[model samples]
Target: MRLHFLGANKQVTGSRYRLEAAGLNILIDCGMFQERPFLKRNWNDPPFPPESIDFLLLTHAHLDHVGLVPRLVSQGFNKPIITVEPSVDLAEIVMLDAARIQEEDAQYKAKRHQKEGRRPKHTASPLYTVNDAKKALPLFRGVKFREPVQLNDQVTVTFREAGHILGSAFLEIAVKQNNATRRIVFSGDLGQWSTPLINDPTPLDTADCVVMESTYGDRSHKDAGTIEEQLANIITDTTQRGGNVVIPTFAVERAQELIYYMGKLIESQRIPTLPVYLDSPMAINVTELFHRYCRYLNEESRCNFEQRQTPDLKFPSLRLARTAKESIAINNIKGTNIILSSSGMCTGGRIKHHLRRDITNPNATILFVGYQAQGTLGRQIVNGDPEVRIHGRHWPVKAKIAQIFGMSAHGDRDDLLHWLTAAKQPPKQLFLTHGEEDAATALAATIKEKLGLKVTVPDYEQTIDLT
Candidate 1:
């Protein structure tokens, strides 16, 4: 078998990998590069022909993992994109949103260049159109967890729960070659063990070789308090100061998780019952999907609805801002309220508009609940940049910036180790990817010292022969 480290090598975004086994070309993911340094990679031609790939296996619907699907489809890749059932719906939403953003961004840039009376360095056009995303949508094949999908007579693949998000999964591929069976495991993005909303990640008893994500592998989330506690304190303090609490949210799992927590907090009266606006249309749709896919949720979240008949996402003060007019009107509200907008990394979407309004207001609070990739606006703000350029203008940062480390979906160092150790027998080789050099290297050292396993941190575009 030949393994190709296509992307997400020594970096946190753009997760794509290729495997040549059983006489098939399988692509693990087709993610976009969000960090500033790697943005050009999204436009680069695929190292391998897109049409050559027989199948695409997605881990989840997060933008970093699935954003480039439309581009791949536009580049002549038309094949079965397999994932969990929930991801089938979620990924479509994410891709459509990304395509829309790409179009909008292109128009914005073109107009700016025209206004400046300067020609753009390159043609101001979208990387991929909405039609491209639509084309990709038809190729998705959603499967149930643990259902073996046979690619050919020699290869079978199964998706198992990864606990990272709704429908997130790690992959188990079994190959029969030369009268022997070998199993290869890919840990997509392992989640915390006992987190809310999602079930724990499934443990593996054995594997012949393993590929895993090393995001947050260098450190632990030893924050001062739990997510709920920190959230309550931030909201209470911000509300008391007569300021809106603006949360830059991810539309997928993070947005829904915040709503779940906020609903519980309001019920207990831990924080004042202020108006909560879900401003992003995409996030609203994803939250609604959570209701439809209740079976995929953790036991506690499922029981909350089944036993008590309680609305997990609905409350009297919770408002849905689905239209552009409604989203604009949210900024007109006079008093304190909670606004959750999408593009968690502040890379795009309505969160930029929300930040434009609140970022200059000292009373307002900008709270982040997810990891901000380096070079993203969210990272700049979290890093305490005094001034930031947003929407082509510089704005002084006066908002009280805060973050809840414990709220991240990716598991930390200890959690990754625990998950790896779950294997009854150590694999012959392990490859770590999807993290910055420092983080991946740190985890590599620990794994070598503790597990005494042969581990390699492959470089971008590197390939290795496993057999």
Candidate 2:
């Protein structure tokens, strides 16, 4: 078998992997590149011919894992896309929202360039359109978790809960070649154990080879127990100063998790009851889906919902801003309130508007609860940039910046080690991807020292033979 590391090798975005074995080709992911330095890859043609692949095995719905499906379809990848059931619904929402953002951004940049009498290095066309996303939707085929499905006569795959987000999963794949069967496991964005809404990652006892993520390989999470306390303090401090608290959030698991904690704080009166505005329309929609798929949530979350006698996500001050006008009106609200918006890395979205309005106010606070990829606005702010450009203008960064470290959905170093140690026997080979160079290197050393296993950190577009 030959494996190709097409992306997410020494960086944190654009995750794609191709496998060729038994005269068949399969692509594991076709994500868009989100980091500023690599964003051009989203517009570039696929390194491999899209039509040459026989199938796609999607692990989850995060944009970095599945964002480029529409572009793949536009480029002639006409094969079945397989994933867990909930991911199908969530991915559709994510794709459509991405397409809309692309179109809007393209138009905005074009007008800005025309006004400035200068042009971008490349044509300012959207990577893919909404129609392209529509075309890609029909190819999705959902399967239940833990059920083995035959992909062809030579290969079978089973999905297991990853605990990263709703319907996120890792894959257990078996390939039969030369009358010998080889087992390969792909750990797709494994989630932290004891997270509120999702189940813990499924443990794998064996494999011939393993491909895993190392998003947080260099460090362990901060104490999870202190997340609520930190949040309460920040909110209390910001509100007491008569300023807004703006949080740039991921539309999926992170946004809901924030609401869950904020609800608890309000109920306990640990923080004053202030209006909480969920400003991203996509997040609002995803929150509703969270309700529809409550069965997939963990037992603790279920019990909390039962005890609340209402939806677990609902709080008295919560407001869902579904329309553009409603979103705009949030800026005019009087006194101190909490505004949660998306494009978590501050790449794009309503969060930018909230940041523009509040970032320069010394009385306000900016709270980050997720990873910020390099070259992103969030990273710049977190790194203490005094000023940042947003919406074609620069703004001062005077707001107090804070991060709740334990709220990340991705598991940290110790969690990754725990997951790996669950294997009854070490695999013949282990390859780590989906992290920056420093992070992947740090993890490789730890695995070799602690587990005494051979580990390879593949480079982008590099190919290796799986013996």
Give the top-scoring candidate (lDDT): 1
- Clashes by residue pair, model 2: none
* lDDT for model 2: 0.90
* Model 2 C-alpha lDDT per residue in residues 11-121, reported as the tens digit of each score: 988889998877779899778789999988888898899999998999999999999999999999999999998899999999999999888888888898989998764
Q: Estimate each model's TM-score.
A: 0.98, 0.97
Model 1 collision count:
0
Q: Can you write out model 1's per-residue Cα lDDT over 73-155, one digit (the tens) per residue? A: 98899989999999999999999999998898889889998898988855378888899999998899999999999999999
Displacement of residue 31 (Cα, Å) in model 1 is: 0.6
